[model samples]
Target: MNLHETTVVLVAAKTATLAFGSALTYLSYSAFRRTDSRALRALTIGIALLTLGVLLGGVLHQFADITLEASVSVQSVFTAVGFAVMTYSLFVDIIDEPDRTRSGARTGD
Candidate 1:
């Protein structure tokens, strides 16, 4: 196939990917509400941000005024923020679990 056709195919694939990502983000948010877990809240934020990053990275570079490098940089930053949030969520959960386990045992659980 031609390069343009290939690019179109790739863009289609990305659109599908973003749609799936958005669904996951929605699921995370729903899970957060039911559980009220801080970790799940952070995870929801992370997924939302990461999906936004992916959207920006895919679309912003198409404009003539925006440089590809600048779009990539912004995308990288957003993705990094998402990952940082998720890492904090994981750490918070990890720290709480052991403490809860120990406390429960001591409290005669």
Candidate 2:
């Protein structure tokens, strides 16, 4: 693709990622209010990080061709880390919630 096209694609990707991140943040906040669970909070944070990674990936792709040599290597690294952490937190949150609820029920009984 042409440089212009590539740049456009990168910009679009970045915008979309950022938007998604914002939405996730909002949803997480809502969930937090409704559930007051740490797992939900962690999951929300992870979603935010994932969104950030997407944003950084887009930026890195766009900067790859610029004359200014604006490298996205660091951003890419952070993105990967963020994705990993977020994914892990999300998984933990998913798995832990059921156990927490079950324990609470057993205690009540």
Candidate 3:
């Protein structure tokens, strides 16, 4: 199809994918909260940040006349920060002593 049409299709696909990812992450966050998993809370935040960033960029592009380069830069920051949060969270463990049972040991998660 035409360039404009192709761009629209691509953007729609990207938004759908991001939305789906965000939904999954939010579900994970809820699950983590149920068990009060401290280490994994940061993972939820990271996912949220990335999701919001992607959505913000998409909305801006579709509605506003902002430059493409500026939009990319703005969204990149969110993605970077999200990854950084996830890295820090995963690197730091909160368990002082491992809780185990006779059955398969659970992660307390």
> Tens digits of per-residue lDDT for model 3 on 1-109?
9999998897987778697868968886997889777657878888888887787777777678777777777788999998998887665453433453435557567
**Superior candidate under lDDT, 1 versus 2:** 1
lDDT of 2 by residue, 1-109 (tens): 9999987887787788789788987898799889897767777776776676566555555555533233455556656676676667656754766556633456545
Each model's C-alpha lDDT?
Answer: 0.84, 0.68, 0.77
Model 3: lDDT of residue 71: 77
Task: Provide the clash count, candidate 3.
Answer: 0
- For candidate 1, the per-residue lDDT at 41 reads 95
Candidate 3 to truth, TM: 0.75
TM-scores of the candidates in the order shown: 0.77, 0.61, 0.75
lDDT of 2 at 48: 71
| Tens digits of per-residue lDDT for model 1, 37-74 | 99999998988888898789878887645786887788
- Name the TM-score of candidate 2: 0.61
Q: Over the full model, what C-alpha lDDT does candidate 1 score relative to the true structure?
A: 0.84
Clash list (residue pairs), candidate 1 = none
Clashes of 2: 0
